[model samples]
Target: MTNPVLVEVVRSGFVESVHRGALVITAPDGSVRFFAGDVERPVYPRSSNKPLQAVGMLRAGLTIGDKELALGCGSHNGEPGHVEGALSMLARTGLTEDALACPPAFPLHEPSMLAVAAAGKRRAAMNCSGKHAAMLSTCAQLGWSTTDYVAANHPLQELIRATIADLTCEPIETVGVDGCGAPLFAFSLTGLARSFGRLVTAIGGPERRVADAVRAYPWQVAGTGREDTVLMRNVDGLLSKGGAEGVHSFALPDGTALALKIDDGAARARLPLLLATLRHLGIDPGDEAEALAHNVVLGGGKPVGELRVTAGLFG
Candidate 1:
């Protein structure tokens, strides 16, 4: 069945736009508790899959400290701290940033990027640099080639693929190139949610270790004032990650997970949908809706309208 229209862009007292999407909520046992939209179709989960991949690195004997582990699973905002953590991982392994395969980009934070541009530098501040650094470090530690480490068929990538399959409890259907030039696995949203659930609930494996690091260093997961960090900071026993193209996944300590993607890639639609989904699931996350209020509609540089769930859609 087709996914429902999950959000509408209301502007000037009208529904100016619409966003269709899929959502899957799964339990620790990989049971589907609730689903909406095309949850069974396979799609690249983008950076939301970082935690799963990071756990694979952990299982591969990749030893990293607290902040480094967080960065391994982060789409960092290029803050100085994040950059230091990423570069430090490379340095500890006697590697350099030049060894990375991901393309260089400015920091995601506006001020950081502005400062960087003012200094005539667009260095390896891309959000995925930490992940790349960790991947390269893994290869170096294992005596694998740093060259072509980003290749889909590389041994390093093979380990990651197997890890993702194990976490999601399903075989992958396709492989796509992620923005960071690493191979991305295409899997069902149900599988995505289940993967996150498993990560949160792992008994004593690499999954729990990685999840613990991310939860402890929430700032590295995104950045100061970022939604993922804010939500993770406020909500107890929750791990949240968002991806490019509107993909997002979050898990509770009990291993409940929700994964979703907005069809048109409307990132603005995600927070409200998250609020609605949380409320629908009977989880009262105090001040979370306000924490995400930055995405509210505006007119003439002032408060105008607000985005809300369609009446009774989550009821």
Candidate 2:
């Protein structure tokens, strides 16, 4: 079935466009509270899988502290701190930036990207470098092969697969390569929400560790002015992560969880839909979130329209 329209673009009081997608929300008891569109279909969670991967790394003997662990579960903006953190992670493993399997890329943060433009793109500056470095560190500690840690059959990847299955309560429907070169596991949006619910509600073990790190070091997760960083900073006891191709997920300390994917991969639609879902759960993330949700569309450098969640979409 086709996905339902979840967001609308209003220009001069008229609907100019719409974004279609699927979303699922789970209650504190792990029951589906609300859902729209094809929540059962499997789709790539992309970097939304990072937190689960971090849990897998910890289970496989990764010993990084909270800050480093946060980075491991993040898709950072490649700011100075992010690059330095990835380097530090690699150094601790007796490896270097050269060991990262993710391709060289500029920072996602525009200022940082421009500042380092003269230095050229480096693998360490790629957003996924921290994740790759963490994988290498796990391999180093376990005496596994670092050269092909991103390989699907690699020990680290195998462990991560098991970890995801365990938390999501669903077998992975497909295996794919992530944007960062690591193995990607595809599962239903409902399963994704279920996993986040598990992460937030876990009292102990690697799941709690991953969730704690993401909450404690929100900056490490996404860098300055990013949505995940902003939301986590303002909302107490919240773990938020956004992935490539318009995937986003979050969970509150109460085990309230949400997962979403924009059908057309328009990143602009994500926050609006997210805010609508949060409202459905009686959450108010305040001014910054409001600003993000009501994203302005420009015409000749002036605001002419805005993106908004479709009226009653969540109801």
Candidate 3:
């Protein structure tokens, strides 16, 4: 069955388009608070899975400070600090950016991208470099081969897969290569929300460590002006992460959690839908989040319309 429309694009009072997707919101008690579409079907959480993977890294003996840990759990915008941070992780392990497995690419941040263009594409500037560097460090520390660390059969990846299963309480349905060449595990939206909830509410251990690091170092988790950075910075006690292909996930200190994936992979639909979900849960999310929710449709370089969640989806 097809997923239902979750967002609509209005252009000058006309419904210009729609985005169909699935979402799940879990209460602190692990009950489904609200959901739309096939919450049970397995879908990739993309970079949204980073926080879970960070926990896995810790469990596997990866040693890094909280700031570095946050960077490891981020799909950063590759600003100067982000690039340097990843490099520092590599430096600690007696390695360099050349050890990274992800393909060289420009920064996700516009100004940084321009700056890096002069040096051409570099692996350190890729958004996933921090995660890759962390994975390599984990391998180096455990005496595993860094040459093929991104392989699904790599010891680090194996541990990560197991960790994801443990936190989500669901076996991975499929494994695919992610954009940055890390192994991607697919699981239900319900499972995704549950994992985030577990991370936030854990009394101790790696889960809480990961959650705390992400919340405390929001800038490292994303970067300037990014959705995850903006949301986490403005919303107290919130852990937010957005991924490739329109995947988004966040958890509150109270263990409430939400996860979603846009069917068409339109990034524009994510924040609006998330804000609407937050409002449904009676969370204000502050003015910055409200402003970011407006995915303006521009005509003649001016705002003529906007993308918004379909009315009544939350009700």
TM-score per model over all chains? 0.96, 0.97, 0.97
Candidate 1 worst ten-residue window by lDDT: 286-295
Tens-place lDDT per residue, model 3, 1-315, is 334647889999999998989898999876888888888899999999999999999999988899999999999999999999999999998999899989999998999999768888899888999899899999999999999999999989999999999999999999999999999999988999999999999999999999999999999988998888888888889989899898899998899999999999998898888988888887888888878776799999999998988777866
Expressed as tens digits, the lDDT of each residue in 91-171 for candidate 1 is 988998888888888888988888788665443588998899999899889888998999999988999999999888889
Sorted by lDDT (best first), the order is 3, 2, 1
| Steric clash count of candidate 3 | 0
Clashing pairs in 1: 3-37
TM-score of 1: 0.96
Candidate 1 lDDT: 0.85
lDDT of 1 at 236: 83
Candidate 2 Cα outliers beyond 4 Å, as residue runs: 1-3
1-315 in candidate 2: lDDT tens per residue? 334757888887788988899988888777888888888889999999999999999999888899999999888999999999999999987998899999999999999999999999999999999899999999999999999999999999999999999988899889999888889999988888889999989989999989998999999999998889999989889889999888999998999999999999988898888877777777888788788665898879889988887776755
Predicted structure 2: lDDT: 0.90
